[model samples]
Target chain A: MATIMMRVRQIAGIALYLGLANAQEASWRSPVNVLSRKGLVADQISTIWWFLFSTASLVFLVVITLLLIALFKKGQAVPKGPVQENSSVRPILYLGTGLTIIVLLITAVYTFISMRTLAAPSQKPALTFEIVGKQWWWDVRYEGESISANELHIPSGEPVHFSLHSDNVIHSFWLPDLAGKRDLIPGHPNSLWLQADEPGTYRGSCAEFCGVQHGKMNFTVIAEPRAAFETWLEHARAEANAAVSEEARVGQAIFMQQGCAGCHSIRGTAAQGEIGPELTHLSSRLTLAAANIPNTTGHLAAWIVDSQSIKPGNRMPSQKLSGEDLQFLLSYLMELN
Target chain B: MFRGALIIAGLAVILHIGVILISLERVKAKPPLAMPDTTGRVVSQEASSLLKHYGCGGCHYIPGIAGANGKVGPGLEQFANRAYIAGHLPNTPENLVHWLMNPQRLEPGTAMPTMNLTSTEAKLIAGFLYGYDNDAR
Candidate 1:
């Protein structure tokens, strides 16, 4: 029994640790790594929490011990009425109450201060992002350009403030190690902040259930050094600004030939539909189908072949295309450069 | 006081255990939710019926049928006649065929997934679509 309890505690601790996402620490099946300064902050906060919990527990144990002693002591219970003037109880009451208030006030202030410290508001506002929560996926936008689907790469050591919102139901964005949880509501916007103190990747998941694929709706945050992040951002901006390539040009014609533009978007192309995530940087994303499948040609093909198999009840419909058409379209997507 | 407290705690524990057991039994007795319609894979039926079965009518305003109305997808009444699938795809029969057969194949980045259907089934469904030309307006 003791071993079982210890195992449970160990499992829970690992779970809590994994819950904290940092970019460099590559967790299980996670593309992001936990090697970041935010990991340190999370550890610090966890320690503080444990310390406070232990202290309060000690106090509770001591009080309970006193109560048990009082309950079973040698004092003869005089079957009495309401004693008006209890001499010993009054001072003890004042002392206990005073001590409790002092403890509460101190602990409350400390917690508040720690939270404020964790919520780092930058002096210069180095980074900004808009995180949109859909049925189960995330639509992340940096500055004016939007990168669809799974991946988020930001410069290391820069605090990024995120404005989170939802399209349909309410969802929550949580990267426990990086910062905290922020809710995404349909009509309103909520905000949270996180910054990787070093170069790393961190795993994040939907803390709130938006729909059927909520459990599978996970994303990553990559905290790259200044140069790497800048290069990535440059590529993203280029993808946003780029025109349809020659290789994809014929495929683009075919894209319209098939009426795919009705519900999807590719910047600089005729497909500007908003019902779906932007495909401007489709190839750059780590996963497709709102994070349900990994972003690869075959998986993309399978998901496109059978979406219900991947995410049941999503609004997207299935289409039956010829193998040649499928190849051309897949090529066009891979050529999203 | 100690004896009384012990007796009360024991009774509370017993009641709590009983309630937990009863709740578990009640939960186990309930049936599961019905399996969803699998017609998403079947496109041999009429496009109208398929749309109805799939609940596309709930959010889409299909044009040909007078009563079939929904706002989810673009109004499909003249959707068949539209020149493009998403925005820029030239509305052509073969193109619509491709679009119908597999939309994601053409637009790797679109939010619309490739609805599971054989190429022939897509072409057959596209057969009912007639409004892609200028006459639908």
Candidate 2:
């Protein structure tokens, strides 16, 4: 009997663990849901939102009840005739006005208190990243470090600072589940603090109406444990892996010679152009073209050959490469882990 | 009846002038092309229109182009008088044409992009720049 009881307990524990793991995975996939906040700043914001929502709902319910009473109550019906100076009418007006003032005052105080808490992080940020907004992509980097595009990584349970700037037009940095929207204006840098309570992935996007591809300007933030984040940073800082196979080697040569090097950069190689995103560790990223599409082999090839069809009016013109050369280039790019 | 006719005619004239002025403001002038000068360079207005079409005014401030007051790149007020194209290549017409066609070839890491201009388009743009410079002088 004792052994059977222990076995049953073990099975229950395993089931509970699986349930929690499934819940965590599901929450990450819920994109930009403000109420499902996973960060410190977002927690505060959602608290305020819930407070306001409930208060407003209560007010609405009360108002509707009063309206129904006024409409249907037989003896208490408001007089349609003007200047009757009814005793009941005067008291209702005063009561309604007083209640509105009191509710407004309470809401104002609650909102101000909640807003003040968001001004600074609970703890000092261990890492600060400079996030630059371009025409349709995000450039994430630390000072004097290697650059990554459209994806950000931060350690959970601690604050992360971000200094935002725009290279061209005004763009807004908004991670709805983590923090509020902050504008990145050219010639004017802005700063924000965000913290994730748990390790998960959150979707972020440009909130401002920038240009044609504004809707497609999306990014992902991956929150991990401190040790895992450190490992990632070390790997990302290193140069790209060298092409090994013969086809990949030929692809690397074609990339250098065929004007691809003119726009993109692959560190430790001759392709040092900085006009577009760095391609040093392209294979490791989750998405492509500012998170417009999945980072798959087929999508990468389509993007290379005809990026305009995927995203019209973007800066990358469709390349006219031979089928063999394209295959080779794809192989080489895939090796950039 | 005569007085009403005169008033209607005056109002029509004023409306016509207003329409013409509004159109002039809305559409930047696409003037006719001028003949090739002594230097064998053909001055084409189509090239000036092309500058607007390609949104070059979003970066470079070309003279005499309306709404071309972008502060990203240096102003092209006297482009012909510049000694070097992109501060490196000599400012000859042939070199300028080549630079326009393939800027990355000349300078590997320039912020100026390779716009994939055909040879003819590059020549026309070069002609316009030189012609505008001459006019400014």
Candidate 3:
């Protein structure tokens, strides 16, 4: 008993320490995940959804109970045909059908009303990011500002908003653990938002039938300590002015000579092509080739050589560079961040 | 009852096949050349240069046009082969002309704005685009 008590005390102390560390001082504080939304209207809708779910469960339980009772009254040897109920079956039938219809009608009304109320006057967005989803990729641009995909590098604790749209075909922006799904239509922009609760990698995907390579569409909401992100920003700024070493300079020259900049932008150079992915912070990203391939030197080179092998139908073409040229380009691309 | 069940099962199987067909992304029929579709229209380098002047791909999808894969509009790969122009308009030159003139006349909620093309320019573009095909430039 004494040993168990001592162990309990120690565990309690550790839990208390961890709880203090996890206090809401440096974490996201929106209640959308807490209980739907911090908004009054959203909270009400969420409450209604929970209520309907519970009510459906209750009705299911009652029906199941009656079904079990009816089944057990006779075993497997029971009558093979539908049994006629009591002579007063009309009332029960009418009531059962009426209740079912009523439940469905209420649910439909509640769903429509709540969805409609999402755009109410009180539901003004907190912040917004223009997320233009493409074939197996997403081009997120901050409102009236530029947000390079090389670093999802969002400011911590603030509501980083998202305005969703598609580039190639229909795609959906869904960060299930953080926010909801929004459809990206061509020539049409839909809006959504999320405040990452903590500094971690929140994965999202394209939830619509985009094309042959729709399954590979994946993005991450990477939140970090504000100061750390600030350091990253400074590093990104310096990358534009990133001095080219002799080897990298030769590689940069190769990039230019090989016409890489014609289809890709390198920020502070003449290669202002917008057809390909931005190599501004190409090395900083966790994945490459629209998150289809892992970001390793060999993989990057392989992707540059034959991207179609990995992501079958992406827009970038397979370049047949010699081994030396491929080595040189890889060196240059790795220095982008 | 057994016959009824068989018929229902067969119908379900047919429906399943139809769904599988719909879900399968149909292979886009590539043209033999970069010329337009059903019509044998071909765009010139000068006329291609006119693409930039007009910014045709700004709100439309046109493969190989300069700054073509922009996010503002749908990408053009099988545009001419599409059965409908907008959401519901028929795929015909005159119908397309009517749509290009005023889209609201066709689909009330279309996001594509009327480009107001001249009869000559429209016919030329229609002919050239109708012939676009499978070969990569």
Candidate 4:
């Protein structure tokens, strides 16, 4: 009885472990990896995809049927003796050619109609955003406001206009759940419009191959109600509040003393380096390093010590600081919100 | 056919050379100004390593430093003759040291990062920059 109980307990533990593992895997794939239709543009694109897929599948089935008939039908086989033309051969050829033309013309017309619909510009946009692609990151700026990076906040049920530009090389802005990918070309300005139907966080990526760290260049689009979006924007536009705690104050000093301010800018303080992302109101963000890691104190400290370890070839250099200084800087950055 | 190909190649070479000569003339129109050692101070040779270790070369262009041709920040060539540091602060030895050590305090939104350098290191770097001769370029 004792051995049986022990065996049952071991099986229960294994079952629990497997369940937890499955949950973790599901969370990783949920909302982030799926091709979603959470926005107006995405909905339209999804419809077009369905239409194209069904039509292609029909064409594939028809071709396969013809091939099978040609292979298996004894009557259609090559002549072993004298060749003779069948009465049905000419009509079959004519019918097949006419059907192919009709199908192709229909597919072309549908494709043109979808293209025109997607390309039509919005009459009036509720907000305008300008996103400039850099070597391996994004510089996102709202019209006539302070610049932010990696994350964009927009209001649900409202059309938003985006003007894309590239500072160095070509990079494509793709928010698969919100809109189509648009190229950001140097010396040329391209625009797109998108609207979210509900409140949710959608992931975006740099679709074009830009540089060494292109795969890691990710961003988030947070959709909320208009009132909430306005509130967030107002707060983002203002300078960060002063450090309140003694530890935070020490971290603030260390931030300036250690030259952290040279590459990252925290608006209320003197750390105004433009080569990297803006860190003002950083605590409010869910992730760091362009969503490569979660925004926890441990992750932030690790990133400061060796950014290359987290995301190799990123512009932020690895820093060497004492444990005390590192703790202080982490505390200071956490309090920026 | 061979003769025609040779003439075409010659015209291509001439066109390439003509483009190069035109660009070179354009580059010569504005010559870089000379920077003199106004303070007559000597910088330690160790300052170069300090600059590299601190990642100063990751943003600014400093002469005689390997991998220091970063275009993010302005070049340090003829830095002493410039009337201002960061386009605002007066060019003085003391000001340069202060700016190097704590740039954010001096200018809030300036792109120059505040490197946490010791007073001695800041002085050494400032001396090297101020004493840079344009002839080296």
Identify the runs in model 2 with alpha carbons over 4 angstroms from their true place: A1-30, A75-87, A144-146, B1-137
Residue-wise C-alpha lDDT for candidate 3, range B1-116, written one tens digit per residue: 99999999999999987775544323222223332333321233323333433445443556545333333345556556778776576778777556655554566534443345
RMSD of each: 15.0, 19.8, 22.5, 19.2
Model 1, position B98, has a per-residue lDDT of 85
| TM-score, cand. 3 | 0.55
Q: What is the lDDT of residue A46 in candidate 4?
A: 87
Candidate 1 residues lying further than 4 Å off, grouped into runs, are A1-44, A67-95, A115-122, A209-213, A240-254, B1-137
True contacts kept of each: 0.00, 0.00, 0.00, 0.00
RMSD of 2: 19.8
lDDT of 3 by residue, A47-129 (tens): 77687889899889977887788678754443768985556547757877898888889888987887776544343445466
Q: Which lDDT tens digits does candidate 1 get at residues A18-64?
A: 34522222242343323233654555567667769887997799789
Best prediction by DockQ: 1
Deviation (Å) of A187 in candidate 2: 1.9
When 3 and 4 are scored with lDDT, the better candidate is 4
For each candidate in turn, the TM-score is: 0.58, 0.64, 0.55, 0.63
Comparing 1 with 4 on lDDT, the higher-scoring candidate is 4
Docking quality tier of model 1: incorrect
lDDT of 4 at A254: 94
* Residues A1-337 of candidate 2: C-alpha lDDT, one tens digit per residue: 3444544554454344434534432233344688777889988888888988998999999999999998888875456767565675788889989999999999999888887888887678889998998889998888855468898789999999999998799999999888898999999989999998999888899999999999889888899999999998888888888899997899999999999999999988999987788889998887777876556554576678667756678889878777568767877998888
The digit string of per-residue lDDT tens for model 4 on A1-337 reads: 3444544554454344434533422221234532467888888888878877887898899889988987788764676999777776687688878988998898789889888887764558868999988878788887744457888789999888999998789999988888988999999889989988898777788999988999888887889999999999988888989999997999999998888888888887788888778888888876667755555554565567767655678888878776567667777888988
Error of 3 at A174 (Å): 1.1
